[model samples]
Target: MAATKKGNTEQIHDLLYQALETEIGGVGVYTTALTCAVNDDLRKEWQGYLDETKTHKQVLLTVFEELGLDPAAAVPSRKIVKHHADGLVAAMEMAKKGGDPSAAQIVAGECVVLAETKDHQNWELIGLVADKLSGAEAATLKKAYEAVEKDEDHHLYHTMGWTRELWIEALGFPAVLPPPEEVKKVETAIGASRAEHARDDMLKHPR
Candidate 1:
């Protein structure tokens, strides 16, 4: 385990190295967004942001290279990983013990919804931060991540709308679910019903 930890330290060095690379990679995503953007306002805004991210990548990469770290090393934080694994196990165990498939489904749905909400909120927060930025640090984050602001907004808007459509389609329930027992049975039967519909929707529309 000590040896693994040592290796992870080495890997950690690599991951930071790769994190800079990831920043470098982000430029392309931003640039693509800039090119594909139809709105002039977005084009300039996205391009400005990509340019900033590219500069950030270059600066950090130079610093990493100066520090003698391998530019492509991997880093692992065992503690954090173990904690996450434990949390997942505990959550699953709780769900299983509760024996409520509707709750499980709701949990899954909320995770997705919460993640999307966070992404949307991040844009507003970042944009607010950008308003207060100045000098090199400000320029670095704003210009580089500028596209990110737009991307974040786009992501939240499009995903929220798409998920809303999907949510409505998937769950047009009249109001309350059936009793828990029936809910569990129906949840268990979802896959079977989907398959039946695929086999013949007309025959199973009300099934």
Candidate 2:
């Protein structure tokens, strides 16, 4: 879409809200998973990741301010993050429930899928925005988006790959797919949270 300066600003505003939702959802998942992780290393991996996502949130909010919005008052709004996080949590739960290598592998596969999907989604959104945005502003947002997307790609290709192999070695195959209803529940909860949070962020960062 050809964007006028005003249209570009509005589009970016909408995207920032989406980004906020994602950051919160990611943070929530990491915090929750930290409570149940069996390995110190896994806990560390996610902990560091949460910090990265938090940084992304701050940068995007700042970008909003540069665009002339009151960023501190603005809420971040990436609802998809919750759904993605829920998938990871469900995988962890699956590992505990079956106590079998195959089940664990299956769960790990799910995590890989989630991570990969996140990488693609964020890259595309930010890249598109970069294309539409001008000069230093576009460069700023694209670089930030690339950083987070790269982290997710690493998790998908490395952490999740090892996890899947471990499952194959133990169970010969994956054990289960997440139930649709469970996913639906998470979507509803996170989506509601996103709406409320977006309103809060806008209030804090007013246009």
Candidate 3:
């Protein structure tokens, strides 16, 4: 069977749907990560992100309504995104089954970072789409992007720090707990660079 072609609006709708599901999975991922996290500060941070991810889904739902897109409609691409999330969940479970609690925590951290990497890029692309739109559609997507962009940034950046620091310790290398700077809260390019520098400085005196 020939595949149905999609218009620009249809494409955007599918992308939004994909992003919506990813955010939904994000909440679960963060919740699971918190369960395995031994670091109090990291656990606290994941808890906050889990909350933000929930709100992000609501924001996307509102955007769907504004665009007259049905949130319940199934899209193939979204199924792929969901499967990826499922894979992450299974990996965490496998780690736990092995009785390696620390490995499980690291796996969860890595999964959150992976999920957020896609989530962050999705919003950035949506921002570009918003710039090309007009009137209410533009307003709706732009608002949604602005509302979640910073949180998404924090999820990707901060969790990435946790993943790295955790791995460093796992490898018997001196690692900084709670990384010198909270990279997750960083939303700007310059902020990311600063966080990198902070990590470098901390690595010199790992606890």
Candidate 4:
């Protein structure tokens, strides 16, 4: 029984380490995306996300310390996450080197949304598994999840909005300036879906 519990704790620690690495990558993604952003609004938004991502990395490190896990631990999952992030970074750099600034901005938006997709799911799964933990361990995971979940949601949904809108504009379709999510202050799954659909319809109708 003790061995089984130890194995489980090790698994959780591994996952947390991966998540910490992902957050570190998220900061890089946001920083690069901010540089590619052509619109002032989008640049400001990415900057805010970059700040949040930095804080998230620190928060994960705190969780590792709380669990007596080594924050410097190298794991396969972290390597995978790092590889994906590096690919995105390289893609952004490629786009930037080209002459079309608008296209580069669109590329950056897409890359950010892709990285945030994984980053968001990581936290959501952590939140779910946190229920299986007990005592101070559970408390630590739950606190970290609560602290960062909303920011993760904003990062994914907001960047998805930016990606779609930028692509629409690039294709000569009318795009939402700030996106409905921003205007409506969407914070829930239902709200995000509604905002997304509404933005799509607006693009299709194009008044």
Off by over 4 Å in 1: 1-110, 172-207
Using lDDT as the measure, name the better of candidate 2 and candidate 3. 3
Could you report the Cα RMSD, in angstroms, for every candidate shown?
17.3, 15.2, 4.2, 2.6
Over 1-207, each residue of candidate 2 has an lDDT whose tens digit, in order, gives: 464742566656666666655565566655555555444555565567667767766766766676666644444344455566667767667675776544554454456446545644665687787776778878777777665665554444434433433444456553111221112222233443443334434435544
Report lDDT (CA) for all predictions: 0.41, 0.55, 0.83, 0.85
Would you estimate the TM-scores of all the predictions?
0.34, 0.57, 0.90, 0.91
lDDT of 3 by residue, 43-160 (tens): 8988889888999999999998888888888889889988988888887778778888888889988888899989998999898888877778889999999999888877887787
Displacement of the residue 87 alpha carbon in candidate 3, Å? 0.8
Q: Judged by lDDT, which candidate is best?
A: 4
How does residue 51 of candidate 1 score in lDDT? Answer: 70
lDDT of candidate 2 vs native?
0.55
Q: Which is superior by lDDT, 2 or 4?
A: 4
Ranking by lDDT: 4, 3, 2, 1
Q: How many pairs of residues collide in each model?
A: 11, 18, 2, 0
Q: Write the per-residue lDDT of candidate 4 for residues 176-196, one digit (tens) a residue.
A: 978877776776678889998
